[model samples]
Target: MTINNVSLSHHGGEEASGLLEELCDAYADAYGVEPGEEKTVAFRRRAEKQFSRPGFALVTARDGGRLVGFTFGYTLPAGDTHWWGGVQPEPTADFLQETGSRTWVLSEIEVRRAWQGRGTGRALHDAVLGARGEERATLATGPDAAAQPVYESWGWRRVGRIPGDEGDYYSAYDLFVLELPVSW
Candidate 1:
């Protein structure tokens, strides 16, 4: 696939209506779940509402006018460190509280199965973080050691992992951080 042809857009509010479902479906499929099992209404609702918040931003990847991938995040408030729901499990309040004012918590990054390994993920990451210089950006991913290499290559470091819910059969996750210089 020609990655250069993919366009990125910042979607917000009701504009995020169907995207939560799309992202969740892509994520669930990547973990080998059945179609029906992937459609969690509650998850979708929570994700949609979260993305609609003021500090949140969602970048969508489009190829030939079709949505292929997306990534979203927002500034972490001072009082609350542990934000729950959406694609990420609830983090500890202390884990998030130490971040500076520029702290960013990435909520999700997902590409359709057909579009994997095509640089869409990198494009989304770059588009999202490129504008914020010197801010600390963090994300938590389920135990997929393979993803660690990719993140490290992009300047992120392994920090820690919050315990996964017993309901999460995939694996425990790892938290990663990239302390960017305040040059931007």
Candidate 2:
């Protein structure tokens, strides 16, 4: 699909697995992750796990076939207590009842440095969510202006925070949630 002159493509996790190297390249470019570093390897491993989950999907933005940005995620199953374990304020049981259809967890989103501020990220975000059937979505990013302000501008509200985990890529981050369209 073409959006604002950038070509957008959607893929199931299986197919997306083949593009991990390229996806990582885009990630490294956007975040300054040194090539062949431990963090890069860890990110790849995480991406693999994400791809293997049920309801997984990926969307990529390309400019003449070079990745400019991408977004991907999967739906959470009911009772994923581990996932909710990090939320600062524990959620109520009613809010935790997912039934596997209530939430889509956006695992990764990035726009290459060259493409930043030109709407490429927004385009990729909209393309992915626009294709999702879930009633709502959530994502986590660092709790700072440099990290989450853009998400806030896009309508996500910080519902809570996740304490940093013990890992190279782990850090305390604010959790944001957004409701998807629901026509009565």
Candidate 3:
């Protein structure tokens, strides 16, 4: 279906819970996986936890009430071992010292397969990141993921890679970070 008009809306973490299932389903479908699969299930669980973080933000794109795409993330606390520890080569001391206030981790951004290449993903991504108050944003993307180019085009630079954990879907992912434009 052609999306002639995609309307985007921003919602707080709690307010976005209602659409979680739909968002997860869209994510699975976009990647050609079933929602009940192990990786998808894990992703859903992870998303649920992320939604509870302080400053969590979600942006959904809809076409006449039908969900087309969505993106969400939360601020990363500095010194957080969970994320920084996973990097293959240790990050610079400055990068490791995340007090949890400087960076925003853009956890997920997905669009329905039917909606791919229509700019819906970009719209949703920009809507979420543009609204963020953090100084920089980070995300991990597999080298082969289609969205990698889109991210690069938007100024996300390759910084590093995280060696994939055993049983994870992808073997490794190139990490990307973007210094957000300071808004006056």
Candidate 4:
């Protein structure tokens, strides 16, 4: 599918909440998982929580009025033990300090299966990250995910891995971080 006609838009949390179903559909299609399954259910709940975060942001791409892709994240709370607790190889003290600012946690980026390689995902990812005011951004991806190379190419570096949680969506994932421009 050609993404030449795709349009991108940034949405605030309230607006993004309304797009949850469409976002879940895109995620399900991309991952070959059925909606309402264990992982999908968990994801839906997480997305809802993420949308309510203080610095929540979402960027979406639509092709001819249909949602094709989206990416969303929120600023990480400083000193939030819940997030840092997952780091496999503990990071340095500076990295662990949150101050309720510092890092933007990219929770999810998904494109419909039919739109995988047409740049929809990139457009959405870049749109979301480009709008963040945080000093850096972080995301976790399955160790062998197809997007790993894309993240690396975009200047993200692997920091460590987080062990899988019981009944979680991912078994284990490598954490990646990228420093963002002070001004964008």
Q: Estimate each model's TM-score.
A: 0.74, 0.92, 0.88, 0.91
Clashes of 3: 6
C-alpha displacement of 30 in model 1, angstroms?
Answer: 4.7
**Candidate 2 deviation (Cα RMSD):** 2.1
Check candidate 1 and list the clashing pairs: 134-181, 134-182
Q: Which tens-of-lDDT digit does each residue in 96-132 have in candidate 2?
A: 6787888899889888899998888888888888888
lDDT of 3: 0.81
lDDT of 3 by residue, 100-154 (tens): 6688889888888898988898878777888877778899888688778888888
Question: Which pairs in model 3 have colliding backbones?
Answer: 76-100, 77-100, 78-98, 78-99, 78-100, 79-98
Candidate numbers sorted by TM-score from highest down: 2, 4, 3, 1
Candidate 1: list runs displaced more than 4 Å: 1-3, 24-35, 39-46, 83-100, 166-171, 181-184
lDDT of 1: 0.69
The whole-model C-alpha lDDT of candidate 4 against the native structure comes to 0.84
Question: Residue 77 in model 4: shift from native, Å?
Answer: 0.9
Clashing pairs in 2: none
Decide which is better by lDDT, 2 or 3.
2
